[model samples]
Target: MDPSVIATLTAVVSAVVGGAAGEAGKSAWGSLTALVRRRFGTDAAVTAALEQADTRSPEETTRILVDQAHADAEFERSLADWAGETARLLQYKHDVSNTIGGDARITGTVIQAGDISGSVNLGTPGPPERRG
Candidate 1:
């Protein structure tokens, strides 16, 4: 709407509300005064909105949080699915293919393939020692 019209409405509402505030049954007036104070005196709307937001029903709060969690979960799943699909399409599976036997050699730290490390090396293991 027009800024001037909004200002006029705000002033009228504030005066009416300010006039009614500070007494019994003053919520309506208090709200109006709050609106005025929010615009002119101090930006109290942020504070008021925060305060009012706290009054939200427990169900509403839970619904909001649940919605957020579900969205996050779906987003994560979509990313994982996309990554797997991309990998498959890019033939990353073939990266591990070994069509010929003895093509790779296995080496180990001599960690006792047997019970005793008799002359066994205490290093990490690689592929089996065979070349096709």
Candidate 2:
């Protein structure tokens, strides 16, 4: 199983369980459950694990899915597909909306960003300014 796939599944599960994904998250979660049921419905343990996702840790649920994916090639492919789709849906939920309105005045540089991972430099380095 790919690490990225695991990361995506973890994120989606966290978002859905945390109630932060909203309608898109709910839909993605539903799709995931349906996919699991279609692929592993006969397995009572798998179904139970999925059913208890909200109560159990996201990592645990993810582990169950990952383990099953490892056993079945087709299930791995389907799981990857579900992770990809869910990732896109979750991305939509995180759309950034930046706005400066209602008589807002700008003085200097105004930087707007979303989901920045590392340090952000807006300008070149300069000597410290002295105040008398």
lDDT for each candidate structure: 0.37, 0.86
Across residues 1-132, which tens digit of lDDT does each residue of candidate 1 receive? 234333333333333333321232144334433533443355453334324433654234323323333556553343334323433333321123224247656564322131233564555789898978
* lDDT (10s digit) by residue, model 2, range 1-132: 999999988988888877788787778878888998998886897888778888899999999999999999999999998888888878866646689999999998998876777998878799999999
Q: What is the lDDT of residue 82 in candidate 2?
A: 86
Those runs of model 2 whose alpha carbons end farther than 4 Å from true positions after fitting are 94-132
TM-score of 1: 0.18
Q: lDDT for model 2, on a 0 to 1 scale? A: 0.86
Top candidate on lDDT is 2
- Provide the lowest-lDDT 10-residue window in model 1: 89-98
Clashes of each: 9, 0
Candidate number of the best TM-score? 2
Clash pairs of candidate 1?
102-131, 102-132, 105-127, 105-128, 106-127, 106-128, 106-129, 109-121, 109-123
